[model samples]
Target: ASPADMAHIAAANPAAVQGLLADLEAMAQELLAYRADSSLDTAGATIRAQAARIAELERDAARYRAMRDGLVSGDLENNPIGEAMYELGERVCRERGHDAIPTAAEFDAAIDTAMKQPTCTCPSGDGSLSWPCPQHPPEVT
Candidate 1:
């Protein structure tokens, strides 16, 4: 409604627009800096997470090695027992004319029979008893 007001606004409009543009430029620069900083932070977090994962994998590998060694040792210690079981299975197969690989029931029965049979303490070595009974250790050959 006022001519004087309109004239003043027209005179200041260019300078005001320039100031706004300068402010926008500054804000853009800040945004770029913030992006660079945030990317570095993200990279650090990723590296730390990966390192922890690698450590966990190493620990798991160690445990697996230990378990494998224990199983091998147990198998070694029990080999004689397994051999005895196989021997009994073989004798039954040969005498009865059955398959060499005995069934589970036959295997169990052979094991039970072997356990129940008398184990002679003599050094004859024919029985399943330990050689050189505690009472009479054989003279060292």
Candidate 2:
């Protein structure tokens, strides 16, 4: 383009220029407000803290499902081992901490340490009373 054409495009009434500048300033202010998320600054720390905690919870859940899966597929002789694992997981949560996420190895070690020869009773909540309980009828109870 010619210099003259450029000058013409750049030229404008002083009042119009002021008006345009004011409009742009207003738009910039609006944009700044939007960037801050409305009329004022937001509570970013709280929002992020809660989200981080939720992510931790999700990880904990994945770990828990992994533990439950072990119980679902077991020795086939009986589910006592799995039930013991479940009780162990709950105990770890209560004693160790709610956020505790036990690994399979941790569970395996616990189960191995606590496993007892089947007492011909059941591992249900009330094993002593439910010795011949219908749930897990003993072979020779």
The digit string of per-residue lDDT tens for model 2 on 8-125 reads 6666767778889999999999998898884334567677888999997775565566555656777544555566677788987988899897777777666554443434344453
For each candidate, what TM-score against the reference?
0.41, 0.29
Predicted candidate 1 versus true structure: per-residue lDDT over 1-141, tens digit per residue: 499999878757998879988999999999999999999999999999999999977755654454455456777555433555668777878987776577666655544453343455565445556544545556741
Candidates' C-alpha lDDT: 0.67, 0.67
> Which one is best on TM-score?
1
Lowest lDDT 10-mer window, candidate 1?
A: 109-118
Q: Which residue pairs collide in model 1, if any?
A: none
User: Alpha-carbon error at 36 in model 1, in Å?
Assistant: 2.4
In every candidate, how many clashes are there? 0, 0
